[model samples]
Target: MIELVACDMAGTTIDEHGDVYVALARCVEEIGVETTPEAVQEWMGADKVEAITALIQAGGGAASPGIVAAAFTRFKELLVEFYAANPPVALDGVEEAFRTLRGQGVKVALTTGFSRDVAEHLLASLGWSVAAPGVEAGDPGKVLDAVVCSDEVPAGRPAPHMIHRAMERTGVQDVRAVIAAGDTVNDLAAANNAGVVAVGVLTGKLDREALAAHPHHHILDGVKDIPALLSFPN
Candidate 1:
């Protein structure tokens, strides 16, 4: 029996594309860097700093400490504004699945590549508050047994360390006791490394072809299949 469920926020739980694109593009313009949307898409599951580094490199711009800081600061400001302008939408049937999982005495945890601030802010914005009763919406922490942020990890995706950390803290020694759900190759890689069941959802920047290249046990059009995937048998 699966005792816990862990999920990636951006590109997985959070609707991928659109607002993020505009925010990054506007930030690029404001920071005086000419960039193309396709370049940004390529760096989709990476950390903010890594993305900035990649963006600068691809755009033929020099990566300086000062320039990097300026670019990230501008990106955060615009990204926050974009989130405020449009509400975060959780994927289909996710809330119901979470509720049912918790009811079955299963522990819920979240692991994401997003910084602590971004993760908390996004969850709060979307009402994923996970209180004792469970994540009713954006505030998911209150209900989840634990949360592992990228800042707390040695490395980002494609690394099992983050998932291992979450499992360690949650006291899940057996990989079979946990289910890792994500939307990117990095996500699948991390899950596979941690020896957990990997489930992929096509709610992110990657298309079916990209996702199929990885070792995902279940592939779905969206997160709507989470409940069924868990076999809650409703």
Candidate 2:
């Protein structure tokens, strides 16, 4: 039986695009690097620095402390620009889905590629913060058993570090009893690397065929289907 759940934010739990790539492009542009949507799409589920690094490497460029700092400055600038004009929206049924999982006695945890500050802000505003928002009286306590930030990991998704960190925090050793959910190919890859079941939701950038083709265990339309996922015998 599954006792722990490790879910990913951005695309898996919410829309992946929401200012991420926009910020990326802006940062790359500021650094005089030309980036493409396809390239941005490749780094969708890793830490911000890793994405920037990938951008640098793909173009046969090198990054030093100075370049890294400059890119981050521009990235933050773009993020502020995005939020100043347009806040992001969580996917439909995301809140309810988290609530339902908490009610089912599942120990929930979160893994995300965004920085701790950005992830916390997004979660706080969405009420899907690290755990559920309202956890008093009729409310549930923070829904998550733990949280693993990409920055906290050595490499980030597609590396299995984040998932392993969450699993370690939750003390879940049996991969079969764990369901790792996300919305990107890298997320799926991370889950697979950890030897846990990969559950892909379509709300992220990658669609069903693409996600499924990558060896994910299950594919769903959105986070709302999580309850159904828990019902299966393991």
Candidate 3:
């Protein structure tokens, strides 16, 4: 039995309309770095600051601390404006899925590449509350058991820290009883690194083909399909 399901936020649970990527691209371009869709997509599920730094270097710009910090600040500003104009919404059936999983005694947590501020803002906009790290458990009445952000961990996706941190936050020790699901390659890589069941969803930037190229156990249409895939009892 799966004790916990660690999910990604932006594309997996919330439909932000890909504005995050647009904001990232704009920030990098405003820094005078040439970036392509492919370049931006490659860092989709990564820490925003890290993504900006890499994008700067990859685009042949000097990734100085000041430059990266400035770009990140701009990205945050752009994202806030974008979200204010077009509020985010939970993906269809995701809340129901969360309820079902929690109702069945499974702890559902959200893990994201976003920093704490951005993650909190997104969750607040959706009116979702999550338990902070180091808490033994979360309130069952809340939408999520815990939320682990990239900033909370030493490193983000492509590293297993975030997933491991999620497990720690929820007090789940056995990797065998955990599932990590997301919509990008880094999500899968983190899951794989943590030695859990890595499930990929097509609700984000990557397509079925792109996700298939990475290591994953199950590829589903969206987060809504996780309960069905898990074969949870009705």
Candidate 4:
């Protein structure tokens, strides 16, 4: 039985309209380093600072710590402004899926490449509250059991720390009983690295072909399909 479900935020669970990527692209461009959409897509589920540094290096600019910091700051500002004008909303049936999974005794967690502040901001905008590990046992009324941010872990997606942290937080000991779902290659990679079932969702920028190139056990249309795919009790 699946005891835990670790899902990604932006493209996987929330409909942010790809504004995060736009902000990332603009931040890199403002630093006088031209970046392609493909280049930006490569770091979709990575740490923002790391992504900015890589983008700078890929574009032949010096990825000095100071430069990376400035770019990251700008990226945050851009995202905040964009979200203020165009608030993010939960993807169709995601909350229902969360409730369904939690109702069936499965823990639902949101693991993101976003820093804690950005992650919290996004959650607040959507009026979602997740219990913090080591803080609370998780409110039964909350949509999520826990939320693991990239910055809280040693590394972001493609590294598996966040997923591991989620498992640790949720007190799930068996990797086989955990399912990690997301919309990017990094998400699949992270899940694979963590030795859990990797599920790819089509709600993000990547299409079926792109996600198929990665190591994933299942690729669904969206998060809402997860409970059905898992054969959870209805």
- Which candidate's lDDT is highest? 4
- What would the TM-score be for candidate 4 when compared with the true structure? 0.95
Q: What is the TM-score of each candidate against the true structure?
A: 0.84, 0.89, 0.94, 0.95
| Residue-by-residue lDDT tens digits, candidate 3, 1-234 | 899999999899999999999999999999799999999888988899999999999999999999999999999999999999999999998988887787777888999888899999999898888644433324543778889999988888889999899889788999989999999998999999999999999999788999999989999999999888888743
Across residues 156-192, which tens digit of lDDT does each residue of candidate 4 receive?
8799899999999899999999999999999999999
For candidate 3, the C-alpha RMSD (Å) to the true structure equals: 2.5
Error at 177, model 4, angstroms? 0.9
Please report how far candidate 4 places residue 200 from its true position, in Å.
0.2
Q: By descending lDDT, how would the candidates be arranged?
A: 4, 3, 2, 1
Flag regions of model 2 displaced more than 4 Å: 130-141, 232-234
Cα lDDT computed for each candidate against the true fold: 0.74, 0.76, 0.89, 0.91
Going through the candidates in the order shown, the clash numbers are 17, 2, 0, 0
> Candidate 4 at 53: error in angstroms?
0.7
Better candidate number, 3 or 4, judged by lDDT = 4
Q: In candidate 1, what are the lDDT values of residues 1-234, reduced to their tens digit?
A: 887788887777777345766766666666667888778776555566667777887778888888888877887787788787776777766666676677676766778766788788887866666554343434443446677887788777777877888788777889988888888777888888889988887888778888888798877776556666767753
Residue 41 of candidate 3: its Cα lDDT? 87
* CA lDDT, candidate 3, residue 130: 64
Q: How many clashes would you count in candidate 3?
A: 0
Where's the lowest-lDDT run of ten residues in candidate 1? 132-141
